[model samples]
Target: MSLIHCPECGNEVSTEAVACPNCGRPLAAPAPTIQRRVIVAEPRDDGFPKWVIAPIAILGIVVIFLLIAITRNNEDEANRTVNVNLATQRRTAEPRDAARDTSPPNRIDVPSSSTTVNPPAPPPSAPAPSYPSSTTTVPPSSAQTVPVDRASVVIDAKIATGAGAIQSVKNEKFYLLDKDLDAILADADLEPIEGNSLADSFGLAVLYPDRYGDFRRDALAAISKHIKYNATTGGDGRAAIKNVEPDSYYLFGITKAKNAFAVWSAPVSITAGENKLNLQPARLNEIAN
Candidate 1:
């Protein structure tokens, strides 16, 4: 029986009163009681606290990363070692048997390494050299290299006089031409004098003044500016040609006379030694103007 305030009038109602007596109003119904509830958590079987899960998960991830890095580093080191071995093999001068070459030197070999590899005991030791034939049996000039790069030439030239007299040509230049003398003098318009003999025509042609200056100029121009060798005759008409290589060449010279000229074209093969040539007025020797 709880006391309550009246709704219609300001009055205190007693324990068993159904209505308020002072205000003649019925009392309001009693208010229901509000109950408080207490809730309890369920127990966990795992002993670890919940706050430690984040740090444990983070530490596990770091350990996994470290293991992965270590594995990758080991793999990279192995790969580098393999690559270095391959580079070493490539730099080798010759292909070697890998198993045989890598073995330790002290390893046992059948039949002994020296017995199989060494040349048959060279008759204990020869009284002579082991080569037996080379050191003592040497040839005299077999190995000496004699240079044949140059040779020499000597020539005697003469022009026929009118009265069947042969005299020495003076101040005449004789050229050693590699090309054919016929080819060189082809462009020159030199008309040979008609006679029974080349010596007779040559003697008769020298009576007049010089008429062969143009032919001489044309012949010199055809042989080019490079002359291998040339020599001028003294008063005796003898010239010595030096430093000529050992080859076939033509000894070409033009002797000027009053009205005619004589040409010497001798195809001579030069050797390592001295060579001599004579240029007298002849039909077979001239073979041309």
Candidate 2:
């Protein structure tokens, strides 16, 4: 314990005393002050971290797996469909392949050493070529080139309309018909209407319009065989036909004027490349009767 002298009594006293005891003066030292601080927590912007992440992650994985499985299933179905189609096509083609395989197998002869064989001599000269006449008929071929070696012809013909005498036979139809073909219309089959032979443009197209479609279709089918080729003239009396074979054919057509209808029937011989036949059917120009 430390001692300090009291000011009033000049007596000795302990430093811890609030007052001097010797002089009867009270002396208590002030107790030391202590301060405490309390910390306050603020609410967070995001919700509490109580949500389980593992379950959500597992659910997402399951959904992804299901989507993958569905995609694989769709792919499998498409592949199966394609495979089925390919199998069907193969089945369809097998018959065609079998039909085409009809030729007999090649014969391989083994000559014995004891036997002697001789090769036949080739012919001295080939036979002369026989060309198709007007009556000669050719079977239609699978390919176009063999039927007609791209032969073509263009014919422009006018009609005598009296005073003017020569007028363009407007909008006429021409057919290079294989007259020899059995499919061709015979002369007896041509019916006359209003003085116009069914062969005339007005008679065929205007009088019996319903038959025109069938006639046109039939004419085209005879390319190189029956109705070899056909064409339609514009305002001018001109028609271009590509049915030129190196054979003979019949140039047949129908044209018209104001009061007169004309039918053109003439035998034409087409040479190799290009051939044009001038039609002058003045006798048949008698007014459509």
Candidate 3:
């Protein structure tokens, strides 16, 4: 059972006794078993101060947001530092990449500090040498010296000549047969034969003038077997003789015989009025026979 105190006067009261027995004031009927509560102050319906509560909540939210922003900023700063480091490393390695492409001799050393960037000077290029590209002409194979038993002569018969028969002869296909017109005419004390066929092959005849007397006539007449000379035309009655030296007259016949013919050979020099010739043994036999 619960006990209750009297409300009017200082007294003890049972939860079942509502009135005070001592006071007997009116002895209100025994109060009910339920105790009545006393009302001292009325309850108010007002809330906490708006200004203080709003600022505190706002401050808490701001503190959480600032922590997140600081964490993100730190992360971004770390990434930027890494990127910068990587770029610096790439820049430092650029020279090594170029050196690998170049030759070993052309490679240059790098400085120890990577922060100091520099471009190296280019290497010198090798010089090119100049050379000849033109060709030299070689001499003919047959332009060498060789022993000869006979002489060869080319007669251009288009010109004129006066002799027994101007003919060209071959000395074993080696040397050319030639004579000296000045010397021959001077020794004989005769004028140079006009229209002489020294180079003519045909259409003209050569005659020995009587300037050297019978000795010259005999010397020429003793020869025979005269062949006609021609450059490209066929041989006619005329023959071409070559003038090699002025002191010599080439003989065309073996002996002085009428209607006898002989190929012309190189002339030899002789004293004035001299009739003998220093001829090859084969030629001498041919002339004598």
Candidate of highest lDDT: 1
Candidate 3's residue-wise lDDT over 23-135, tens digit each? 64333455459879998998885787677888999999999999999999999999999999999988876765554334221111111111111111222642222222122
Best by TM-score: 1
| Per-residue lDDT value at 282 in model 1 | 27
- Name the regions of candidate 2 deviating beyond 4 angstroms: 1-149, 180-183, 187-225, 281-289
Residue 119 lDDT in model 2? 15
TM-score of each: 0.38, 0.35, 0.20
- In angstroms, give how far residue 184 of model 3 lies from its true place: 99
lDDT of 1 by residue, 196-219 (tens): 232223322232213323443454
Write down the TM-score for model 1: 0.38
Q: How many backbone overlaps does candidate 1 show?
A: 3
On the 0 to 100 scale, the lDDT of residue 26 in model 1 is 75
Residue 94, model 1: lDDT of 33
